[model samples]
Target: MRGFLHLGCVYAHGVKNVIHVMLENRAFDTVFGFLNHTTDIENLVGKDPICNYVNVNDPTSAKACTSPNLPSKSQYDPDHQYYATTNEIYGTNDPNVPLPPVAPMSGFVQQASIGALKGAPIQDLQQVMASFDPANIPIQATLAKEFTIFDKWFAAIPGPTQPNRVSAHCATSNGWYDNSKIIFGNNCRSIFEDLADAGLTWKAYYQENPPSIDCLSNLRFSSNIQSYSNFLSDAKSGNLPSYTFLEPKYGNLPQNKNTYTDGHSGSSSFANAEAFIKQIYETLRASPQWSSSLLLITYDEHGGFHDHVPPPKAPNPDGITVNDPNHPGVVYSFDRLGLRVPVTLISPWVPKGQVIHEPNGPQSDSQFSHASIPATLRSIFKLTSPALTKRESWSGNFESYLLDTPRTDCPTTLPSVVQF
Candidate 1:
């Protein structure tokens, strides 16, 4: 539904900056599958219906245009299953190519053990789904050795956005379970609270003035401190918050048609996401705050992309069985994590070409949850707060990459941060 533009431009900010790039809805299997050989790129880059009209002179004609990759249904039904329009476009389960069999237990927990469970039988679809090879893991070492910390959000658990996002802030995934639900408030005692308590200055920069209810309410902070569309302006004015939470603009652009109407593949969200990110990065790079700041780019959740590896089992407090919806009686325990989402940590302190192949969990090689973010914040500001949860311990710690040499790959100069 949405169209993508090759902006073909690079913008940079000033100095004393740290940026976190959250790759939303990035399925580990999908990303790794394509990255495995690169030919699989088609699996993700579906033909955007709006692309045909992106630059067309006629808005009416653009409205009439349609991409075959559009989603056929509005919402997933409990009884009826849904198939991705992307699959139908390419005429196969995987639009790219039939991915190799997912390795058994191949996620953060799995990789921590160096694929020790490859010979074990994959018990379910979750196991069969995690086929991403760690050999080509994208945790650039340069980034890892220099920046604060590099890790995965590890959707290794299940449920939906609210729970996962809560996990990102709270460590425990039991707070909320639905997209339309609110689990936390402004005083919800998050990493932001911890930072503020420690006399640190941090703010969340959202793309839209106010994000959806969940994002707006979950953080529980007032709109005065949060700027959805003014991130560019804030950066340009050297008004960098101690921490910035960048979110996708949803679907306002023509390229992101599905995001607006729900009739398409939500490719517009992706297109807008890419453009917004470029702008943010460029502005951040050009800002005076580039050197001292840190950026954490991560997605809130995976958007049901085919992953080829299995997420390992962690203790689920709410007993939400990941990947299994058949239990009509009650939420049951799942033996795996949720899908894998992409997370990027950018800063002057991050090492170049360094990949941290850790699990993102408290244990070595374990993957992380959203709750880990607060932990990282806590560490950065040296805050004293009760542990968000058991997994919270694994969330923070800049020691690994903090000592690495700074990246030489960054540009010497960048574009000016945009003004509101």
Candidate 2:
């Protein structure tokens, strides 16, 4: 029997625990290109010149060679700024060209070479074309092989962290496009509110102080926020709420204190990030709620990495626009999605080795983005409230991915991290 919608939405089979692990800044290709080669998922794998990272002006210029194994981090963050991404997407720094119907995904090399991105140098920039081998992060790869991977998932916008992160919970950034001056405006409501309104229990857990969801106007003072340590104890005690969102440690933290597990740009240690993923997975697998649990491991945005897939056209959320939020005199109507990110849905109810190549939704413009987070919650929980934004209204849901019956062969553990 299919999981039917209920008040405290359980995975049709039984009571469910939906744990969302929101990581930071990695493109689909940078993380999972190994699986999608002469295959489907859009990455530079098993190809002649996996990716041409030559100079923008001169194709034959010397640059960092594309490698399958990216070091723990990059030389610098790389330029994912709103205007810079426009260049990376279309592969041109030209200011006056019609927005190409299809993006070229060609200028990443040049953009990374610039010093605009944080901690990056103006010269000798590299690592943007790097892709992780399945062996590089064995646990992440094993989980994907063992569960479902959403190949077409994208960020909510083509800009940086703030706006996209806001969209992940709120379904819209309310016309904000850049990391310009605002960390997050107190303008939009988030899915957290929806969960609360419906009498459903949830919590946003963070390893660092001030959970990322706190930036949302509604969650600033929410009592539902808790420490990640609580997540560990709650999972073991089977006291977890209906919905859970996790924020890894961000910013600088001494190795002794706690390594940065957020994995932002090239600063974080891949070893720490992988271990964090492992810890969370093992905890969930052993939990009493394992059978009905669903863990979504995903990134906030591309964070200036290389993803061969071009972002698809999208409906403007709430039909709002930003007039030159970053670039003066230029306007960004929220009509286009951003670079692709990895969305791995892990659950006992999901068939092993499932890969969702396209959307299961009926909307013509249906492409799974951050908005899908709210949309899927609404469907699985049967929320009758108004859509958070026009975007989620048109977004797809993954309730169908949960199998009618829980699988008996689900692994209780994953391969150990093999970070190189």
| All candidates: TM-score | 0.61, 0.91
The clash numbers for all candidates, in the given order, read 85, 2
Regions of candidate 1 where Cα sits further than 4 Å from its true position: 1-23, 36-153, 183-188, 212-221, 252-269, 317-329, 333-336, 359-365, 395-399, 412-420
Model 1 lDDT on a 0 to 1 scale: 0.43
The number of the candidate with the highest lDDT is: 2
Off by over 4 Å in 2: 1-15, 36-40, 63-65, 93-95, 116-124, 181-184, 252-258, 325-328
User: Least accurate stretch of 10 residues (summed lDDT) in model 2?
Assistant: 1-10
lDDT of 1 at 346: 69
Per residue, candidate 1 scores C-alpha lDDT tens digits across 294-313 of 66766655554333334444
Candidate 2 lDDT, 112-218, residue by residue in tens: 66534433443335577777777878878788888889889999999888789889888998767776545554558887778888998899889988666766775
Candidate RMSDs in order: 14.3, 3.8
